[model samples]
Structures are given as structure tokens and as C-alpha cells.
Target chain A: MNAIGLVAFALVGSAKAIRAEFDLFGVTVVGLVTAFAGGATRDVLVGRVPLALQNVGEVALGLLGVCLAVVLYAWLEAPDDRPITLYADAIGLAAFATAGAIVAIEIGLPAFGVVAIATINAVGGGAFADLLLDRSPFILFEDFYASCAVLGGSAYWLFTALAADATLAAAACATVTVGTRVLALSRGWTVPTAQRLEAVTGE
Target chain B: MNAIGLVAFALVGSAKAIRAEFDLFGVTVVGLVTAFAGGATRDVLVGRVPLALQNVGEVALGLLGVCLAVVLYAWLEAPDDRPITLYADAIGLAAFATAGAIVAIEIGLPAFGVVAIATINAVGGGAFADLLLDRSPFILFEDFYASCAVLGGSAYWLFTALAADATLAAAACATVTVGTRVLALSRGWTVPTAQRLEAVTGE
Candidate 1:
């Protein structure tokens, strides 16, 4: 399951690199960073060594995903690539958020920590990639992206606190995150932003 | 010394936030993240729990640093603020790089790891802050900044390998990083880019 998440994250990163017109080396590096940074960040916050550094298999799989993405980029053009990247990104986000929430729970972090860590873990990789490419982070200006992770993580926390089975809780988290994001993407739903208030002149 | 470094890092983050016109809350948040992220990253990579998460005092001091930055920004305009921020940033960069290099050495990392970790540790926080503010990362386009850290870390690694005293190695690392960066800033030194590549069409 972790492997699946990692591969999906790498694909998302590769897509972003492709969009940014990065070279092959940049694409590969971005893919690796995106797949690995989330869990590594969570591990650091919770006072543990990151598993990404220890698990060579995960890294290898992520690199393989990047290679696959390169092939995809060569074979497909824009409109053809968007859906696949979107779906993969959504899945990766859900999986990582759920996994991060579980870790936060295991570490006995507070509610704030659980949600914060999970959301950050889910988004950190993409954010890092965007930063490297000198683009605004998707999370800061995208449709229902980070909010989905927060909702999912919160749901997972709630379920676990209520003595729900671990698998069930995990499922709930992944479902909420992926479902919401997919719906938003398909329907073009977006969060509301602040509007400027009109100035009133003395009439 | 570590405390000073942390404070300086937080101030650097705060200065960035001020430049970006972030609200107070945003300033505080960025400041804390900048101050602590480098060590946290190094700890995670080296298979230890991050000290920032374990120590409340560190968090408090970081917040205090943010407060100090807020006051500085409030009192000082642009030209008045630049020098202080630059000097503090240089100090923070040097201190973090040296500390990260020492950790890599203690953990028996390869020479590459020492330099890579040190450079990453020195720049990660400010890079993150810039990313959050939708600015290009300074390290990607700056003069002699990351280069100084690489030099410093390499010097530290060499000194350690030669069985020099730990304190002396740290001093060497700090001196090299700070001195190089300070000179570069004072001299208006900049890294060479690919501008000439555009003119080489015929050649």
C-alpha cells in the first residue's frame, strides 16, 4: 500500500515537472522528493528517523514510477495527460494523509498535531516540487486539495478515537480525501476566496 | 550558540514574511518553521528524532525571535533593515551548516552526505519561507550562499578526517561560511548564469 502511494506521488511530481518544462534530471529529482518528503517530514515532526531513508525498496519503486512518467510524457500530450495525473495525485494524497494520520495517532500527538502533520505530509511533496520549479504551490491556491486532506485526517482521528477498527478508519480517511478531490476536479468545485469590500464615498 | 543560530533563522524567516507583507500570525508561523526545520531534517535523515519536537524551550525561543523581528520590522524601514537581516541570515546559515556537518560526521555519513546535509540544513528553512511566499528561492539564484556552506561543510569534514579537535573544526566551518558569504554580499558578487548561451547561436 505504501509502495502504491509512493509510485502515485512520484507520477504526480513527474507531471508537475513536465508541466514546468524541467529537464529529465529535474523531473527525476522532483519525483523522488515528492514521494519521499511527506513521510520524512512526518517522521521528523514525531521524533523518528524517516523510513524513506532506510527503505531502499520504496526509493527504487518511486524512481521506477518517474521512469514510467517520462515514458508517458513522451507518448502523450496535454489533454491526454491531465486526467491520469489528476487521478494519481488524488490517490497519492489520500493514501499519504491516511498513513500520516495513523503515525500521528501512534505517536500520541495532540489533535492539532494529527491534522497538521497529516495535511502537511499529504501536500509537502507537491509543495516542495512547486517551490523548486519557482511556482506557487498547488495547495495554497487549488480546489479542495489540502482541505480534503484535513477533512480525511480529522475523520480518521475521530473514528480511531471512537474505537473503530484500524482498517475501517483508514478506509474512511482515504475515501473522504479521494472522493472529495475527485468530485471537485470533475465538477470544477472550488473553495471560496475573500472578496474586496467596496468603498463607500459620502454621497 | 545553537540558540543564537535558531533565533537568527527565525529572524530571517520573519524578515521574509515582512517583505512579503504577511500578517503577524503568518510571520510567527514562518519564523518558527524556518528556525527549526533544518535540524529536524538532518535528524530525520540521520535516524534520530528531531530535537525541535522534543524541546519546548526551542519553540519558545523561536517564537521570541519572531517577536523580535516584528519589532525590528516595525521600527526600521527597508534600507535600515537590509544589513541586519543579511548579517543575521549569514550567521544562521553558517551555524546550521556547521552543526549539520558535525552530525553527519558523527553518524559516519560519506563526505558527500556531510556537504549535502549541511547545505540543505542551512538553506532549507529560508527556501521554504520563500516558497510559501511565492518567491523564487534565494539559493537557486543567489551569490556565494550555498557555495559557502558547501565549502564550510567540506572544510569541516576534512578537518575532522584529519583528527582535528571538534571545536576547531566547527570554528573552521563557521568562519569559511560566514566570511565567504559576507565578502560576497559586500562585494556584490553574483553567480554566473546561462545568459551567454543565448548569444552562441552561430558558434
Candidate 2:
């Protein structure tokens, strides 16, 4: 799950940097940061050393993802909004969210903390990448991306609260997150914006 | 030190949000985030619960700063880049850097980690606020602000390595950070950008 999340997020982040016309170095840095930042943050919150700093294999996986992204970009000519990349991104989000929920649960955090950390683990890297690219985080105002993680996290907490086995809870969390994200993508579902709310109320 | 840093950073963040024409709620959120984000991140990195989450007094101090910013904004026509605000910002940066260094040292982090955390603690909030405002972090490419934190953290580490008392080291760190920042401001100092370096080297 960690390997899949790292590679997928790195690919997603590298695609964004490529689209932004960043140099190769910038693209690679963005990719690595996207892959590692979320997990590193999770570890810090749990009072552990960052996995990335301690494990070279994880860094290698992220670099492999960056290389794949570069290859895909060259082949596809425009891969940023493509279906393949989007699917990979969804998979990554689910994987990270599940992983985060497990960690938070193990650490005996409350339900809110579990869900919050899960969402943070799933989307923090992308948010950081967006900031580096000189833009507001898309998760803040765009589509239904982060909500999927939140839902997945909540599901994990619920399953655990109901005394489900750890593996089952983890699987449920991942499935719920990926399913919701894919469904949202296909159905064009979006969270309402503040501007939209104001318009509706005529205020 | 914590109180001073929180209030100053909150005021600075609120002033920026006001300049960006955000609503009052947005301004308040930005202020609170700017004041607490860095310290919270540092705490997380050190494997402790966030100070903001643990203490209501800290939150209140940040809110006070936000209120102060709102009042100044209403009175001064523009408060974003005023001398008073700039000085306050420098002082906040120094205080946060010192605080972070102390935490990292207490946690037995190496010199590099100490300096890195100090810089992060000093600038993380501003970077986050910039992200919300849809801009790249100024520390990544702008003036020499974060560098002062780096220098101060290094000074702290060096003093400790030389067997100086912890109190003396901390005082030196804050003094160095603030002094350098004020000097940089007065001299209109800026970090050399990649473009500038490229031009100089005729790359």
C-alpha cells in the first residue's frame, strides 16, 4: 500500500509540475515532495522519525514514479487531466487515507483525530505541491477530492468502533475512498462553494 | 516568547488577509493559522500534541492579535507593509525560531535538523497563509527572511556545541535572527534568484 501510494502520488505531482512548465529538476522535487510529505507529516504527528528519512527504498519508489510520469508526459503530450493519471491519483489517495487511519488508531487517537489525520495524509502532499506551483490548494475549493478521504476515514472509524477486524476496516476504508472518488469523477459531483451558497440564498 | 510570536504572527497574517480583501471570518482564520501553524508543526515534529490544541490561552492570544490587526487596518488606511508591522513580524520570526531550536535540541535532533526545524517553525505559518492567498511562499524566492532563522538556528547549535548554557544560546539565537532581519530590511537586501544567478553565469 505504501509503495503504491508513493509511486502514484509522485506521478500525479510530477504531472502537475510538467503541466506548470517547471524544469525537470523542479518536476522531480515536486514529485518526491508529494510522495513523502504526507507520510512524513503523519509520522511526525505520531512522534516517530519520518519514514522517508529512514528508508531509501521509499525514495527509490517515488523516483521511479517520477520517471514514469516523465515518460508518460512525453508519450501522451498532455497527461495532466487524463483518465490514467486520475485513476492512479484516486488509488493513491485511498491507500494513504487507510494507512493514516491505521496509524492514528494504533496511537489511540479519538475518532476526529483519526479522520483528520487520514484526510491530511491523503491530501497534504498535493496541497503542498499546489503551493509550490503558486496556486491555492485545489482541495480547498475544487472538486470532491478531499471529501472522499474524509468519508473513507469516517468509515474506518465506524468500522473500528463496531469492533471490526483491523484488516477488514482497512480494506473498507480504501474501497470507500476509491469508490467515492471514481463515482464523483464519472458523475461530475461537486461540493457547493461559498459563492454558490450566497447565490442560492440571494444574499 | 510564545505569546509574543503568536500575537505578532496573527496580526501580520490578518493584515495580509485584509489587504487581499478577504471577509472578516477569512481574515480571522488566516490570522489564527499564521500564529499557530508553525508551533503546531514543530510540536508534531517533536512527537508532542500541538500547543494550540493543548492550550486555550494560546488561541486567545492569537485572537487578540487578529483583533489588533483589524483595528489597525481600520485606522491606518493600509497596514500590510507598515514599519510597525514589519518590525513585529521580524520579532515574531526570531521568537519562533528560538522556540523551535529549543524544542529540537531538547528532542536531541542533530544540528541540521535543529536549523531546519527552526526555519520551518519561523516561516511555516507565512507559507501556509501565502498558499491560502494563492501565491508561492515568499520564503522560497523572496527576501532573506527564512535565512535569518537558519542563521540563528546555526548560531544556537554552535553555541551549544561550544558548551554554552541553554539560556544563553537561546537568547543569542533570537538576537541574531531579529538583528539580521532588521538589517536586511533597512538595506533592502534580497536573496539572489535562480534567474539572477543564471544571468550572472550566462547560463
Candidate 3:
């Protein structure tokens, strides 16, 4: 399988893990949504009817992801099951962000629009997915995760302007993005907050 | 508020009622997605950015819907305590489908594209919304629901061409849509099934 395919499989697995509380039907639904949610967002932002529904591979793969998730959850049976949800969500965001920006820039979007499209593509599905599942993944409390995605997308757009070193820049962008996410996870560094001294907090 | 605002708020409340198990954030997400999912979809399909973010009112109203839903759910808990999810999902779908058709046809889409776009605008969000929340909504299981949305949208499109009366046709479309949905719910009717009976019977 290609990189995208591998990542998609991981997504299905993670979806199952996340939806362990749900029934089988519910698990299937979660798997499909998590697997295709980002892709659907990317396609919509780029004015391309969703490609996930256009092919059987994606659906089959998503089901497979559900199965894997079920098995993995059964085996793990603990909340500390590594970074299944986090990694899958992050990778899905990055892949879709790349796809969104490329499609936007390809269709002659301006710089700012490209950035906005990329950001939406990256976070839109995950946020919606989390909300539906009664959680708020990255946006609710994850610091700087969304920022990394936007930065990566912007970097990808910038690389388009390069004449010879475009691929190199794209690689750099991916590394920077994935690295930031991993660092945030490993170092326990969150997006900074501004919940400073409140007016209600008296001396 | 305008008619659209009223419809939007009602749809948002309905969405929350349908997705009853969701949290406050989840309710807001579902409400906003249900309320704006149609028009947002129309804009994206026609290569226009979603207007939800452009107009601050839409967001405020959507949040208001969430608040309304929170209050309604609380009140219902104290009184009727009936499962109104099916009803709310239906209302949301009906409104989105009709409005989506209008948006698509107005954008000069051909008959088929308009029908497809309108139907997606109507059913996509609701279906996926339910799927995300692990709810096997009747529309997915009971059947005849999405098909009616398509039919209503198509009727509206056809009527617009023959009568040149936008309001009349839109009303007709909405009527057919709601009627079909309501009858289906009341009578427990469904569309055709193509499953393998032999396999089920072990023939």
C-alpha cells in the first residue's frame, strides 16, 4: 500500500479504538467518518465532489480500520494505548491539509485563501468528528496542534513558488509539521494560553 | 429574525435533540453543522466560500440554536422525555434539501448536478452527523428518507423550469419533502430492498 493507504488504515484502526464504547454499527460509522472525514473536507473546500465515495477502496479500507480498532481495543483495554487517536488525527489532518492547499493553489486561490482552506481542511473534519463523538480533540485543549497544520500548509503553498527546490521545501514542511506535533506530544508542551488573572480573582 | 433565521434556529435545535447524547460542545457542533451545513455545502460546490463565517449572524444564531437545544433538552427531561431525535433530524434534512436545491439551481447547475448537490446539501450532514455520534438514524435504517429529499429537490427544479414561479415550486418541494417524510414515519413505510434473501434464508 502507498503512504496514504497506510495512513488510512491507521485511521480506521484509531476510529475503532475511539469508538469502543459504541455498538458494532456505531463502530462502523465512526470508522467510516474518521477515515473519510478529512478527505471529504478537502474535496469540498477544493470544489471536488468527495473522492472517498467515488472509490470502493476507501470504504473497504475504512471497514478494515474498524476491525483493527476493535481488535486493538480488545487487546489493549487501557486508556494509555499509546497515541492511536492523536497520531491518527494528526496524520489525517496533515494529509488532508496538503491535499486542500494543493487543490486551492491549483485552482488559483490567493495566498490567504489558500492558508484558510488548508487550515479548514486540516481541522474541520477532526473538530466535527470529535464534537460528534462528544469530545473536542485538538481545538478544545490541544495547544499549537492546529497551528502546526496551518504552518505546514502555508509552507507547502510557499514551495509552489520555488522553481527547482519545490520538492525539498515540501519535505521540509512535512518534517517541520510532524516534528512539531511529536515534540508537543513528547515534551508535554501545549499551545500557550491566555487565561490570565481574571477580574473576579481579587487580591 | 428573517424566515431563514427562524428555520436555521429551529434546525439547530432539532439537530441537538436528535444528537441527544452529545455534550455542550458536541451540541453546538452538530447544531452549526446542521444549520449551515446545507448553505455551506452549496457555496463550496459552486466554488464560493461558505458564507457562514462571512455573516456573524449565522454563527450567533447557530450558537443560539445550541443554547435553545440545551434548554429544550433540559425542559423535556423534566416533562415529556420523549425521543424527538427522529423528528428533529427530519426537519433539518427537509430544510437543507430545499434550500440547497435553490442554491444549486440559482448557480446555473444543470438538472442532474443540481439534484445531486441539493440532495447532498440536504442529507450529507445529517447522515454523517448521526454516523459520527454512533446513531443509526431511521433515515439510514428505515429508508425512503433520502430518496424523498432527492425527489422533492428534483420536483422543485422541474417546477421552476415549467412555471417560472420560484416560491410556488419551492413550497411544493418543501411540502412533498415533509409529507413524504411524515407519512413514512407514521406508516412505517420504506423504499425497496435489494438484499439477498437466499443468503438470509441459507438457500
DockQ of each: 0.14, 0.13, 0.09
Model 2: lDDT of residue A14? 85
Candidates ranked by DockQ: 1, 2, 3
| Best candidate according to DockQ | 1
Give Cα distance to truth, residue B130, candidate 1, Å.
Answer: 3.1
lDDT (10s digit) by residue, model 1, range B110-193: 899999999888887777777787877778986678888999999999998999999999999999999999998999877767
Decide which is better by lDDT, 1 or 2: 2
Which portions of model 3 show Cα errors greater than 4 Å?
Answer: A1-20, A78-80, A83-93, A162-165, A196-203, B1-203
lDDT of 1 by residue, A87-159 (tens): 8778888999998999988877656567767887898887777778776565654466777888899889889
lDDT of 3 by residue, A1-203 (tens): 22453345345434433543443433444456555666677677566766654555655666666566655554465322457656655565566666667667778887787777777766665565564455546465767777877787778777876642645655655655666777777777665455533434644
Query: How does residue B11 of candidate 1 score in lDDT?
Result: 80
Q: Number of backbone collisions per candidate, in order?
A: 0, 0, 2
lDDT of each: 0.78, 0.85, 0.61
Candidate 2, residues B13-83: lDDT per residue as tens digits?
99889999999999999999899888877777767888888798989999999999899887897675788
DockQ of prediction 2: 0.13
